[model samples]
Target: MPGPLRWLLFAVVLTALPVTAGVLVLGEGEPDTAPPETAAPAYSSTPLGDLDTATVALARAPFCDRIPEEAVAEALDGKVGPTASYDAGQAAELAPGIKDVAHEHGCRIAGPGGTEVRAWVFVPPVTRDRATDLVTEAAGREGCSRATAPAYGDPSVALLCPSGKRTWVSFRGLFGDAWLACSLSAPSRLAEQELLDRTGRWCVAVAQAASVVE
Candidate 1:
């Protein structure tokens, strides 16, 4: 469940956009069909030790500012899973799953904006999923948000850090520019591992989010 404040902001944004009224797909009570592959890629080039400096600066900017660092960390710091770029059918299949998860957790879902997977918001009903076009500042850059488990329960996003457990996830694209990353844990586990494994997973997520054009 996105907070009331977040939901309100989302609603105001949603109203301003043109709504193409139609039914959206929701995932089956079944498991995800994505094959067991490598995790997605991580988009940030800067090291995590130095995240605060760049992130704080970016947070002050228009689109970047909307997201907090904690949220970014959860979404970007994961083990790279499957590597396939979702086709329309796959995206459609996946979109519903994302939505189902969002609704179950109390967030909202929205678009297929850029080039990756269809973008979705897991905020309150009041909050609208503003297109990257609307938030000119957030155009190409990918960002993320976080809510307590009470609000969002578990996130739609998934990351596979080398640690045995799965971390929560959230991500969004900023004004079509550089990407800003924020991961929750210390990098020693995945970051220190061979093959730049964690970074690759983050990239896959970004690529999937960017593919959508909603």
Candidate 2:
């Protein structure tokens, strides 16, 4: 069966697009760990009363589609070609790292010079310290040294290691319970400094929108 996002792609062609404000969707606060994928039992494999609901989506760019093409072009200097915007269900099916934590999300960008970035915001609030430790341990398993990198005023952390000829970098941190993260696989692990800064900017944007963090 075609994926839900694949279906959205097909529909996007047949519809008109809408306008959105910025890169990050602000004002939503966080929340968690999941054991695994488990669907509620089939209820005796029998039919139950069905509930019908209608969904009305305003005419606007998709969450991922809001990633400004020009910004991506300027940042990565590459063609932003065919891309997929995954909805909550789509995120669940496609992004394992995020499906359990975030439902509404966007992809980092992939472009010229063999550069790529991916990001996520966690829900149910993984405290800053816990997020740091969790990300650090994951990075360690990949042979990366984990540490807390500076993010100006915001709390931040990093996981950096060299893999073969390339480098792996993951940057993540939190503001309130809403946490943001980004990973970059670039030519030098040092290049991650830029990514860390970018992720921090996004986090600040979100926090500002919430009006809770200074």
Candidate models: Cα lDDT each: 0.29, 0.46
Expressed as tens digits, the lDDT of each residue in 72-101 for candidate 2 is 443343575444444433434233243442
The numbered model that scores best in lDDT is: 2
lDDT of 2: 0.46
Pick by TM-score: which candidate is best? 2
Q: Please list the residue runs of candidate 2 whose C-alpha ends up more than 4 Å from where it truly belongs after superposition.
A: 1-63, 91-104, 128-139, 152-155, 189-214
Report the Cα lDDT for residue 22, model 2: 28
Give per-model TM-scores.
0.22, 0.47
Per-candidate Cα RMSD to the true structure, in Å, reads 29.5, 27.0
**Candidate 2: residue 43 lDDT (0-100):** 18
